[model samples]
Target chain A: MTKSKPLPSLIAVIDIGTHKTVGLVGQIIDGKARMLSFSERRTEGVVKGTVVDLEKLHNCVHEAVNDLERVAQRGIEEVYLTIAGPSVAGERVKGFVAVPAHDGKVTARDFNEAMLSAKRLEPPAGRATILYMRQPTMLDGKSVENPVGLQGKRLEVNFWRVTMEEGNVRFRVNMINAMSIHVRDFILASHAAACALISEAEKQGGVLVVDFGAGTTDWILYFKGHILCAGSIPVGGEHLTNDLSVALRISRDTAEDLKVRFGSALHRETDANQTIWKDGDKGVGDQQFNRGTITQVAALRFQETLEFVRKDVLHQLEQIFPGHAVKLDQNFLPSGAILTGGTANLADAAEASTNVLGLPTRVGIPQFEKEAYRKPEYAGVIGMMKAAIEDAPPPVRRPQGTLAWLKDMFRF
Target chain B: MNLFTRLRQFFSPRRDAFMGPADREWRQLIPQDVRRMPGDELGRKRAARSRLPLVLAVIFFATLGGIVWVSIDDTTAVVAGNGALRYKTDGFYPVPDLQRLVGQGKDGAAKDVAAIKADLEMDTQIASADVRRRGDGSLEIILRERKAVAKIASLPGSGPMVVRLVSPEGVQFSGAGYPSEAIRNLPEIIDYRTSGSGDKATIEGIEVAGPFLLAAQSAYPNLYREWSALSLRDCFGAQEDSPGSNLRVAVRRASQPADRPVLTEIVFSTANWRNELAILSRLDLDGLLRRPGITAPAYVLKLSIQNRTSARPVPEPRLVPATTR
Candidate 1:
């Protein structure tokens, strides 16, 4: 904030997930995010989205970022990050201000006053607000797109605020800072993923975005074209793997393999007597597991995770629209629910989401010019890149003097 | 929804929580500097790191090669005296002398230049000289001449009054080789300044007189040129640290035998010639000479013991007519 830097063309994004840390380089060319370099490494010492061991996470980050920088032939100084931890939460806050202009026309100053007033509304103790998305503005109790140059006695602004635990944010920040890089901003992994997968039309209508990461499930509700509610559930694909291990008497690693190999959420829809281990995928474990049993163990845990996400989102929505049967309203999610993230690739993940939420559901994958970008796993990083550009300040054009103009013209 | 699943979800520890030592190993071994130089952390590592040794090798050899080339190469220099290669002192330093010394080969060029400088500086005409060799294979020899600051005027009835030039360093030489006009313009050293014919040697007591003449001539050249001669009788305040001896100076008109000389004598006990000469130069000698009833061929202008000027015309014999009155 104390200095001005030249605008950079290459955008670097780091997505630290529970199982994998991804670093990618891209540039906005012709209104498309074109991937330049991409790198991925197994994340270490991170549980869910929280980095418990700073050093392990730092190495994981360094390996991925270093490889990307090597391939790009340039160093990265500043980057945007997508973080998902149990500390993520959201709140709806509002503020109002009287017009200061003599003619009662609203100005930027009035809008800023309202915004500051709303943000200063006490956040939870030991927590800091990281992001805020503005809702529709009200000019003298009348909703308007732009209050500027409009006659209004008072102006009010609403914000959906995202706050994170101070200690966890610091841990994530230090992991990146130790590598001598600057964190331009921290975005929630779900928001970033949703930004990538959700279309503009889907966002404008009501929709639900669920990013199923390895250790955490992040869900955000978009109602009336605004981010109405968002929450992070401390349960994800890893929990289902653990359940499968405990129920089937298998190692956690073997459980993960089983979950990836044969786990399906729509277990009841498949043949219950189908044998899971008949193909002899491994020579060491000679036990046969019925397809129904694999589904029964994994689906139970995955179903529980979906239930938690649904319950938390409903609770937040009820707080917003009190005394109103919000779910009963037919236009709750016109675009339905869109799922993404590492766990979103799980078999029958959409079916489980649809059965629980009672809405049309589909797995989301971010599409870009590079084929590597069009996958659920890449949704967070690509979306973070898109969001970072949107939040960047416009480039400054310095007025050139006569001498500078001549020098520029004659430069070889 | 059983108690087992609830407890497991509540107390699930992050994976690899016990691998602190392993993480430390990676932290220590990671190549922190993988980029190049002259850029940010990444840029510097990328640009400067991998080929650093190769770049250093190139720089080291380049410097060593330049030094070796300069040490072995033969540099020519122009040898000159004053502003030109030829000097007023003819045959002072010819090209053969330069070629014989510095042109032998590329070796010992510094020694050759020093020898040439010492040889030219030994000439009486040259006060100091410099011999330098340049980087472009050339040599330069510059000479400085000691200007004639004082003149020895021959006494009257001394065979047409020949003039002699005294160097600023107090060496007196016959003015036969110099133009008369230049010799005539110098401040004169009159009585007590003498030399045997063809001696070409300086008169004694010039050490004190030489600097005084030089400083006076430089400061008051216009006035110094008008004077016929500065009588050097008893100058230097006697010999051998003799204090309290009076030094008498008489400045005479320039030589134009048709006109009688304007005579003025100043006596001083100190060699404060600068102040004394400045005061003397300001006196209107021509105005004083043309004053009414002043028809004497010589006069004495004494600087009083207190350093003041007072004049007296020389006494003339009265003529008596041998006739019956």
Candidate 2:
């Protein structure tokens, strides 16, 4: 918000997921984002949305950040954190008030009141919280999508608010900042996942964001420009591979490789002819799994997990906008579901998800025109960086007030 | 009748059987050998020594007559533009500077005399020049042209180059300064090994005039009539340490207009004048001129031939026109 020109500054992101921790440094050079350096390492001490070992998690974040700093030739000051966990929660909250009769002018204070009323929902205990809030519609005696620069008698708000455990976010930020880097902003993984996969129009046109991460799947439904609902399922990509290893009695590593390289989630044309080569182990000679058998085993696990996710997403959508006759495959949402996250890379997952959920679907990679984000996996981290840069107050100002309010409106 | 008649003619002795009266006259022409006195050997030796000049005189007269006949009959008047402007009695006439040979004059001795006087004032070095007529109507020129022992290439834009003239002896004179004219189109001898203006050069022992003369003599031997200009540039010698010790001369061809050789580079060592001449005789100047491929001397006439060097195609011998001016 500083009117003074933004100096050539760097923004870094540390994405510490259960499977991997990645650090990326980007510079704003000549008004364009340029990649300065990037580093990634396998993560430990965290699994299934909870930190099992805090010390190990700290070390993982430290090593990746240090490498990024060295390669970028500059010390990292702060990092935008990407948070993904099962305790995160979302719901649609709306508020409305009659416009002042004499003045009939809806001021900035009125907008703030509506948003505060929406965040009034108390979070459950033992879960620290971070908020993703948005105002979708304004009804000043009439339902309007844009309230800005409009004269109105009454202002009503339709907004989506997501709350997650604040302790986990604080820990993640504090861990990175402990290495002398500040956590500029914390972005809930699902929203960052959604930003990477879907476009602005899809959110307005009713789309589902299914982020299939390790040990969990985060699902959010968007319709009419607001997140109608969000939910998480415990079964994710790791569960499917675990089920394969247990049922087939193979090594975990082999099960993972076979699942990725020879995995199929649907009975399709290519699946009919597919043959998976099984390296001889455990006294079993080299063998092959025909397409039908491999699909039977893989799809049995993946399909059931997807069914559970589909049911939750559908139940939430119906609860939010009742009597709207929102069929899972209804044409009201021209664009269907957008599936992202690491596990969504599985072959035919989109088709399998569409088949189980009875809706169209496609896999999504984070799309960034910024040169720093040439890789799609870094989408969540970069989204957080952008969010931090936007939220920071103008360096010359009091660091509070309407400019900060204006900044929030732009946040994903 | 035979015996008495024969005896009668023999008695008269005018009718000797083996001798005709004309033959007797020829016999009288041959004097009889006289027997010398016992101590006359010493006297006769002295006498022979005294008569030796008379014997040389008879032979000298005969040789003189023959030489005169050959000079008068064989030598022809050459109406060249340089020097006294008239023909030399001996074909060997000197045109100090060939460029001055350009001018028009009348047909007879009057015109020749005018050309002579004009030429006299032109070159200060010329002591005198004369035009003499031979018996065969060929003019003999007795020219004491300025002895510009060195020749310099004074071509309009190029720097001057020089060459040494080899006289009766192979030793070169390093006295006279650089000559700016005679070696007009000679390839300059350069030692690229050195820096600055260049090493001083000369032609034919007259220090300044020598280089131009050498260039003229050497290049003229292989060049055609169209020669326009010459350059003398020093090139790096094959050896590195002993700089200024080894040098070579490069000759440019007249038919080619470029100062540098466009066809072939011809290089010959200064130490091998005779060898260079030998190789020069083998150059087919006329053939090279006639061929469209021989564009310039750079590509064809490579004089840098040695035992270790690969043998290259030698053009046929050049039959240079015998105009020596």
Candidate 3:
């Protein structure tokens, strides 16, 4: 009889947002993701990335996972989830350790000791650290890419620590656990987006990634191939829709439709004379409004959101490198800012970002083999899968010996 | 609690205290990425509640499928073959012979696999038959045949005498497909009383002699090759441990003439035959017969008597003249 081939191992990820919850199941074969199945559902009981009603959110998340299982023909036991919103924040901390070797060579053990010392700093009250990103290592007094085999008396390292409120994280964990699925690890939304959209060259040249969701804006700053800072704000596309609804005396649904169809982030003088109908057909409920009015309302909200993010980035930079004369210009961030997420689909979004942040910007769409996955909204979930594969431990190779062979023979 | 009170409790937000400096100091020793958050008991309970219906449905359907499968007749679709019988055996029984022995009907109809298995096992020679129906609509069978240790002759009332083979278990059956030379080589049991006929026939004292012969045939082939016939006249059936109850085995003469006397018969007590057999296996009979002494044509070896001349009694075999027996 011929032996049957074994099936490849699959990885599953879920991105829970204020507007929608998405589930993806696929296999990472030879460092490339092969999509198997995907499902998404409208979110409820959540506002601005915070769980407000546990039962309603549980129903939404459970249905999405069930649909994915049906299509993939497999059940998901654990998943990598995305975390965002105002409760998430980052801080930079430094650690120092003295070299113990008589030859004064820095070993792997010294590097580990310095890392351990750096992580010893705790988050503020009622918050817990969720992730740690290592920066450059310093030997003696100079920064070195690798400290091993180098001579140094004192070893120091800097780590960008990310923390979140305990109560908020618990709410998310409880919601997912209610569906009989475990949360394996939490990936920050901005970090996941950067992994999907930012290339190695872009990271090496310094870049900023801003993910504009429906209810929140998360951004991460990468300088010299290391994460300098990351933060989130409680303002997104929904705020713009709310602004248009109040300004034009229309319902929220009609306002959203108008914002998607005729809205622009940069209003032009010629748009003042142009008129557009709410509904394409001249039906009884259809109404006409000046095209300029739609652009004006959307631009105000979009620019204010970008300004807030820019101000936050500058403040964090000042805190990290005080009196270093840092600036958000081409000299520091050579690759400029890359915009992504669902809200980034707005017309002239990059233009608005450049006008406000004073840096050249462009919208980034996640590139994938499947055309359906190459959209702004899929960047977070796709990036989450990539992060999970990159963070997984390497496969262990067994030693070939008589004892090992005997153990294998009797394994069954 | 009242509905209002329960509603108030459920909606109330829970505030957790921050970790102290001591706890943080110890936690920092471990890598932050590998650390996991505390478990949620209430969430786990909710998950168990959600999985209950799915688990129950799977179990119910599995049990129902098993019952339906067992209720159906498995042999209704047996593939066409020679008498619709397929079997393997280590003995000399052929396919057609086994089919005839199982009594397959002349009418071409599928028979129950269980019934076929039972019919095959009914024969005295077959120890067991493993019957199964393959997925391709064929009946598969494996048979383990019993080994014959000795032969016997019985004369029913006014009928001709018939020879039958005896198994190690003392069961007698017509040895089918056995070579004539192999059958002739087996020693015959003479002067024994039997109570039954056909495959169920029972010898009066075979229980004591069958295993003794089998043990010698397996462990001491050189000595067993000299045996020609066995006599059970002195053995008492059911009361084998009585005083002086013994079995006599007649030995055949050798083809070549020897200077020493030849063994005529070996006698053993029924109660102590196992110990006597062990002692007999260790004795150098040929060497003893060729020792310097008076010569005789034939002699009888008696191993059932004990030598009591010493303080401790020891059982030993003694040689006597054939005329004394």
Candidate 4:
């Protein structure tokens, strides 16, 4: 059946990062998020999600937003922003307290105190917190959905924390404010994307999300419907392109073109007499080069990236629980891992990730209407929109007047 | 030595100490000459508010005056013939011919705008036309022409059948001002039982059903290709006895496997075509061909009888043999 689309109010969301800038206009129809327009351009005057050159950044954002407004045939006044930079980091805090001393059922105040104990901290001098998620509470020795009426001695609450550099965020916010648009909220891109790529069942069973972009690779861990860790690495797919450029002795633009058209993360047998596209007297797309070399370079870099990402995740887990010896393998994890973002489209990227992490892995794409969710790159923006919809205030209820009351009393 | 003081000191190293927060380097995007006119603070403020509209008004009046002067001076222009006109203007009658519109044997002020509008309205093809004088004194005509809704043949004429293009406003044209594709592809309204001299009067339901046919044809051309004709015999009245004969439309069905075409008549209710087509779209017509005891080369579907959704196909009568086989 064809889905019915009603006229819906539009909401704008922007993802400004190191490699590219994207603007999206979305709407909520029948409580489902739908994308109306998508516009993207190369990053300008920005480094690792920080505004470095103000004038150039202004022009870049103005052009991106203007193009989206034209495509959607509307104006944008507010935006939901996504942040992915080196300064973004996640921490977990666990608080424990006795249930109560009295006989009356453990009051809601006791539960609130237990949960807020872990949240009572000033963000470090220049850092600002973005999100705090609470996991299912532990009563005595077992996890319980609600422990108010149950008899228990011990109550422990765990919260996942995400924070970023305050000055950097404010600078970008100031720039956006100058353009006459309000910033609704800021989210870590990987944290927001976890909502779109991972299902509730997978989250309850524990899953890992790895988002790969051109300049940065972000990872987030969620288990039991709550986040545990999230972080970003400085290196990403750009390193692979740079590696190919140097190894082939070709320009960066040509290397990128060749990498996309011929490169694969899985190696295959090469024909000794066969030659593939390389520069020559022939025109572009006619030039000849060795196809095997392209795949080899891609495979080698992918192997290195998988190893680095695995080590990073393992190291963060160790820090979260110093003495527990958390195993980063299939034996400990049941839901496995989901990969998303631009680099997830690389051939054999999922297989290489599985091999390195020792877990089942698959590429992740948002589950929305196909026309809107055409690519995995939209996972972050779509997730942010879902988050916005959940956060919107409820509709107001009007009071009935005396005239209506009289009419009901006089009904035949 | 305290933490707050030390943290403040560490972060404050050369953080644009002298310049204010609002001060940016690229604030000067305007050229030097433009900046010179609004050099000082008050002058810049005044120029920004006052000089813009003054400059715009000067430009607007200057352009408007130039066009007026050119149109008033030119005198050699005149309305051209129907050959020079873009659309078909054949058999012009109540619509004055080109000779009258061009004001032959009349003065220069002849052919005013209202007269031209009235003359154009006399014909069925011209819906409405906005006539204006161009900058070079020639008549500029922008027309909203009447499109052919269906090709209808109602009353008997000199030929075997009188087929004319029926417009949306329920007017007939003698095959004028329409392209060949329109004449060929428009729905055929043949075998219509009505009487009149084909004046500026309308038979009911033609205008209403016209839109539904156009929409159905555009939406489902492959399905529309199956129907050949519609016989409007007492279509306006409610039918109690012979409802099937009240409204008739021809259709073609293909027998499976052999893919042989069988022509048949389908009787349907006089509802909107879209609604009736929706009912037809949901019907499993092919499933009826394989029903028990159904063996016939061709048959008629009585759709108007029962639940219109379930059309019953009647098998053709077979001639019983006189001799025992």
Candidate 5:
């Protein structure tokens, strides 16, 4: 008799962005992600990554999930969700514990105590921490990757904690629960994008990742194989479209079409003399607009967004390393910056980022087994899958003793 | 607690403060309202699909439990028979006598099945007992009785002498329900040592003598019929390979004619009794006694002792005059 093959472990992830919501079902086979099904629908009732009308968003999300289940032929019980916006931010905290061993050698227990102490630093009032990224363990004022079996009088540890507004998380949880799917985890959008688009070598050599969505911009900075900071700003490609719509005296739809067709984040010498028609065929009510003006409007807004991200990174760095002076240059970040997300499709986005952030920049497309998923727009969801698999928690072990067993039996 | 306070607490959402490095990332943020609310059509369909396997599992487990319950139920009747206790045996144990042995009352109330089986197996005549309760509130019992290998005559401290049968495993039991001719045909054990009293009595050295007699009766019945009594005076307990241990069987003289010299007794070594019996079966005792020079009225056959003066100890049956033995 032939042996039957075991079924693959499938993971479903959903990215709820301002412009569109995407749902994907995939499984990692032999260290490569095998895409099973992909579905996306236009988002509604959400603005700047905050839900305004939960019912409308639920309808859209419900349809997208249904489409995924129908094509994949598997029911999703829980899903990893990617969260972004102004409310999601990162902060650095430090904790130290005195070595208590008789030999004065730092042990795993000392390391754990230091981490626990660092995590005890509470988040701002209405937010909840989602993840704790460890920096490095310090032994006697010197940084060490692993402190165990090393002689030290004190052990110090630093963590970059990511927190989100508790109310926002609750809303998303309730929405997904309404569809009978539990929210398994909340992944920071920038973190997920970095996991998908950035390589380990780049992270080790210090790199920056910026994801430009429709209504929000999320960015993360990595230096010396550790995350320095991550934050999201509520300004993105839609602001550029609005800027064009208000300056060129055109409809928003025409402005969006022009932005996609002719908009550029960098100005060219020939843009002044060139003109682009809203409708190429010159149909009825079609209008003409200066290409230079469109490029100027988009470039200004894009530059401003990148500058904001640059300032945030510098400020966070200054706070982390108080006495040291840091600069955003090639020497500081050798791997430069990688740009991804839907808005990264704009022409010369990398050039604009390079100009504004003072680092070599390039548009990042996620690598997948399937050619269809290797696109800038799918980076966030794909990264969410990767992060979900890599950072999956260990299985909970049942407690011993009769009372614990009885309690477990009665637990729903 | 007040109703309003309880309601507020019930609707409150779950919040996690800080996630340490050791904390799990996949813990759910459950809200009371979400858990209490019903799901959509697709969720309902999925739930229904999941319930199918659970239902089948329940059905399978229920069937298994029912079978086990029926097998161990003491009140269930034996459907094959019309009584509370159904006795099946190859021996002469009557139902009433067996019930009395197991201490069952006449009212036929249900008793513990394990206790009844243990009581039945305690009897010396029974080798094994299987007692089960059927689905019709009756007990079904099947018994295996031990066969008599030889007879032992014992005189208790306060009773008349009684003749009991010995099994191949050295168990002594009253030869109940056996034909008088069959009992009389069995060779009596003499000069045997025994311990204990009554039903628990065990004969010493019966381990060797009992199996020998059984083997002779089974494989060499024609040679076995001439044996009258067996003496274990030289046989040691559980030491069948000892050189000095031997079993002596007295030959019946009634079958021999008055004018002819007859063989009286056969001696077999305990160590190689089986081989000695096989050799004795092939020998023509009448022809040997009729040799021209033999003049003794009775001769003793010694099949146990070997001639050891040569390089190899060779076993050869030797006949000696009864007076010399």
Candidate 6:
């Protein structure tokens, strides 16, 4: 064999989403994500993040994995997995209790206990399951952001508990494990999207993370460094693309391309003036459309979705910030809203979400010191990697014989 | 090369008929007007152009011997001989400090060279090796590597692994570290004993006792892909498929495990190779030979080879009509 130096470590995420499975491998070199290779395979047997056909899902993962292995020329030992679906649900819970009589101060252990107690609000038997346990703020005595080192009579933890189905989680893990890769950790799609796109200050002050994924639009509200509440609507970018496909009588791919290139949330009367070309074939296939009309069709669906999200969010915001009495309109962005996920790429989506949510909005692009880690799509995986790296303990090396044996014999 | 030659022959005209003594008479068989086919001015011009390159080739070849005698003699070896080999040495495999090793050969110089050569080759069994001075006063050496007991199936391809060997005691050796002209002779490993566990080839099952080789690789020296068949015997009771056995297995095609596909064979390797071979040799392969309509068998045969080591009685042989040997 030719003597060549061993290749560098390249991590690839084969995100088997509802619409597509994206296989992207990157090497984290010098704390920077350098892209080594990428591949995309059509996903099947996956509905709203739940796998319907085990074999079909396996095939999709296999194709992507095979392609990545061919490109990277290395074995994939493990993967950081992300999951999102209709089964997933999120809610905010705050635990409040007095400090111990002796300590006279709230400790980190107190915060952890509060967080765990808050997570206990939702059980695993019935509802899907917890995707992530995100703790943002600790309330000590009052609504203090950081409760550490603070003397207080009572301590409270406000966090979000993201849950999905146990069956779905099992199916996904089994599928991944069957591929001979370990799932180091699991992260909720919303939290991952939020962590990737939203700034620390925004999360500390107040911010909302909206992930318009394939099957659901997940919204996570953060305030005072804690997850206030989370919700998901079945309507998403797929619905808009479907609307365009149906209205224009075009193939799904063409509708998607049109939606990506020309479709916008804000529709104008002048759009009807511009015409789009269609092929000479009948409705069966090969057809063109008025580009403006396609845009209008896409806008109608987008507006309806925005309105739906607006009503749901407004109701929640009214409960939390009753003094403010926020009205979601076209005026400004949500103070805490950051749009992310694959559907977040919709042209002017962040601005549109801002317009509807009535707060300052920014496209949630993952902010990592690394370049490859800066994408919204990788938010979940990078977050999982971050958690693993932070939580990982230093390696302990065992001593060999001889000196070690002498040391053992002469141990004091 | 043969495929290309056949392709050329297919497109070329037939020469058999034209080689006849009365070939012109055969031409007259077509028509009188065909004989005067080149009568037209266009035909005459076409004939002249076709012969131009042919004439230049003959003139060029006439002075070829003279050119060769004047310009090429001692320089020919550097030009057309082993020049490519010399270039390949620098381009591919440059020697790695031969003199440095010679310097390191302090205490038993010849013995040190022999030991170093063995280590370099990854081969343990060196039949004979010698390090001696050459005509140029430089050290010249000859070495023979250990033979390959088995050709392991490497991932993606079955190549480099040909240089590896596994002793009877399961110690793996390779010739990767040595430079030798002749390949060492090794015993042919036609069959292997695969168990639930071990450092052999294992495909799927996680529980193993002896080497389980899913596929032969350098990492697994005990197994190879060249063997036409494999017989797993002498497995431990834990690796057996008997009623009282802890290990139970059902072999079926990877695609359809329940349907009991004949293409996929299941083996319960409980202990040693002897028992595994006994189980295989006892198979009713003759009964199922060339039988059709054999999609998949429920279970072909259950061997108690592994059970022999235990106090348990040998299990009954379960036969399937669907199985064709």
User: Which candidate achieves the best DockQ against the true structure?
Assistant: 5
**Candidate 2 on A1-412: residue-level lDDT in tens?**
8576577778787777777887778787545566788888888888786799998877777678667866886666556676666756666666766655465766677776765555454445434335545646666456566664467866777655555565555566555544544455556676766765677788888888887876677777777766667788877777767877886687778778778777777756567676667773534676566656556678877888888888887787787768875678748567888777677777788899888877798887665665554443565565555554555532232244587546544543
Instruction: Tell me, by lDDT, which candidate is best.
Output: 5
lDDT of 6 by residue, A140-258 (tens): 43677667677877777765556556566666666666555555445565665666566667666777777776666777766666566666777777788788888877778877888
- The DockQ scores of all candidates, in the order shown, are 0.02, 0.00, 0.05, 0.01, 0.08, 0.01
Give me the displacement of residue B47 in model 5, in angstroms.
5.4
Q: Could you arrange the candidates by lDDT from highest to lowest? A: 5, 3, 1, 4, 2, 6
lDDT of 5 by residue, B1-325 (tens): 2344335446767424333332222232223133423366755665555456688889999999998885666543343335666667776555555766556446776567898888878878888888887577677788889888788887768779889888888888876777878888889899988788777777889888888999998999988898999999999887988878989998999967777788889999999889899899899887889889889889999998798999988779988889753
Q: For model 3, state the Cα shift of residue A267 in Å.
A: 2.1
Task: State how far residue A398 of model 5 sits from its true place (Å).
Answer: 9.4
TM-score of 6: 0.49
lDDT for A306 in candidate 5 is 91
- Report fnat in order of the candidates: 0.00, 0.00, 0.03, 0.00, 0.17, 0.00
Candidate 2 residue spans exceeding 4 A from truth: A1-5, A140-142, A148-153, A268-275, A279-291, A368-379, A382-412, B1-325
Top candidate by TM-score:
3
**TM-score for each of the candidates:** 0.57, 0.49, 0.63, 0.52, 0.58, 0.49
Tens-digit lDDT track of model 3 for A307-330: 999999999899988998788988
lDDT (Cα atoms) of all candidates against the true structure: 0.68, 0.57, 0.80, 0.65, 0.82, 0.54
Docking class of 4: incorrect
Report the C-alpha lDDT of model 1 over B229-258, residue by residue, as the tens digit. 555666642252345433455454333334
Which tens-of-lDDT digit does each residue in B1-325 have in candidate 2?
1234335556875643422212222112122222221122333443354456688999999999999876555344445533223443222223434224433445532345446456643543334556444455433555443332222322225655334322211222221333435434323323222222222222221222233335545555444223332222332222222323223333344355554334333433333434555666566644565565444334434343445344753423332222211
Worst 10 residues of 2 chain A by lDDT: A391-400
- True-structure RMSD for candidate 6: 34.6
Give model 2's docking category: incorrect
Measured as a fraction from 0 to 1, the native contacts recovered by model 6 come to 0.00
TM-scores of the first chain across all predictions? 0.89, 0.83, 0.92, 0.86, 0.93, 0.78
Measure candidate 5: CA RMSD: 21.9
lDDT of 5 by residue, A1-412 (tens): 9866544677889999999999988865544457888999999998877778988898899888878877877667678898899878788888999999999998888998898898777677667667788786789988799998999998999988887777777778878887667677778899899999988899989999999999899999988888888888899888888999999988888888889999998988789899888777899887888899999898889899999989988988898889999999999999999999888989999999999999999999998777877989889998988888777742233464687746644553
Candidate 3 CA-lDDT value: 0.80
